[model samples]
Target: MTVRPASVDDLPAIADIYAHYVATSVATFELDVPDRDEWQRRHAAIAAARLPFVVTERDGAVAGYAYCAPWKARPAYRATVEDSVYVAPSAVGTGCGAELLPALLDMSRAVGVRQVIAVIADSGDEASVRLHRRFGFRDAGRLERVGYKHDRWIDTVLMQWSA
Candidate 1:
């Protein structure tokens, strides 16, 4: 497996992974799965802002992806970043996340980002929570019932790792 910077060519696979999460899980608060054009636009915007967007390839296919973007719009959040990671269901537990996450952290450090935040879907998301914790992320707070999906309310847990 290899972790590398992502490109427009990787957007389709990335969108697939994200769409899966949007349709089946509360990992993201977004209710609607975005179309390819919107996904491309979002990716392009991130790149245009010079943020780090990375992908992990295994056996010549995109197994997962990870990226870091500004935590918030204000100048006070400039030194901090928010991270997102998505792995194809087939790639789970195959070390795709393990490979991509460190690259994201390294990218953050390389760009002088001081803190990395991960907004987990809920406390029930053990994999994501554990992965972030293993990478030195700690629970920052939990915003109760901040998301609605699948006919239920889902809480969001905020985790943070200092660089």
Candidate 2:
């Protein structure tokens, strides 16, 4: 597998990966899957902000993706960002996330990001939490039952990494 920056052409695969999580799991709280156009806009926005948006390819197909976006809109949060990492169902155990996340964080650091926050849904899957922890992220806090989706209340685990 190879990890590299994502391009416009990779959005469809990225969207598909995210859509699966949205439709079948509480990993993301998104109720509706964003279309290709929305993904395009997001790519443009992340590019314009000079942030890192990456993808992992296995056998010439996008196997996973990772990116960092401003944690908040306020100017005070400029130095901090939130990270999102998703791996394709088929590639989940293939070390795709393991490759993509480190690349994302290293690029974020190169671009002057001082802190990275991971707001992960507590979906009873500890893989994400363990992955973040392996990359030096620490438990910051948890917001109990902050999200309601799929007819159930869910909590969010906030993890933090500082450079």
Candidate 3:
């Protein structure tokens, strides 16, 4: 697999990957699948801030993606960022995230980011939680019942990796 910075051409695949998570799981809190325009806007917003958005390519297709954005709107949190990652259904256990995350972290660090946060939608999503942990993120906190999705009340598992 080759890991590289995301480009405009990668938005469609990224949207499809995220749509799958939105429709089928509590891993993300998005209730509806965003169209390509929305995905484009999201990518632009991240790029406008000069942040990194990376996509993993395997056999000429996007397998997964990861990006970090400001943890909060407040300037006080500028040194920190919140990470988002989504893998294609077919690439879930194929180590796509393992490749994407480190690239994201490396890029973030190079750009002066000092903290990376993972706001996992479901506390029980061990795959995501473990992925962050594997990248040096530690359990920070959990907000009980912070979201209601798919007819279920879910907790937000917060994990952090600090440089």
Candidate of highest TM-score = 2
* Predicted structure with the largest lDDT when compared to the true one: 2
- Higher-ranked by TM-score: 1 or 2: 2
lDDT of 2 by residue, 1-163 (tens): 7899999999999999999999999999989999999999999999999999999999999999999999999999998999999999999899988998899999999999999999999989899999999999999999999999999999999999999
lDDT (tens digit, per residue) of candidate 3 on 30-105? 8989998898899999999889999998799999999998899999998999999889999889999999999999
Off by over 4 Å in 2: none
RMSD from true fold, candidate 1: 1.0
Tens digits of per-residue lDDT, candidate 1, 1-163, equal 8899998999999999999999998888888999999978888877876778999998999989998878899998888989999999999999988888888998888888899999988837599999998888999999999889999999988999998
Return the lDDT, model 3, position 80: 96
What is each predicted model's overall lDDT from 0 to 1? Answer: 0.90, 0.96, 0.92
Ranking the candidates on TM-score from highest down gives 2, 3, 1
For candidate 1, the per-residue lDDT at 105 reads 92
Clash pairs for candidate 1 = none
What are the C-alpha RMSDs, in order, of all predicted structures?
A: 1.0, 0.5, 0.9
Lowest summed lDDT across 10 adjacent residues in model 2 is found at 92-101
Clashing pairs in 3: none
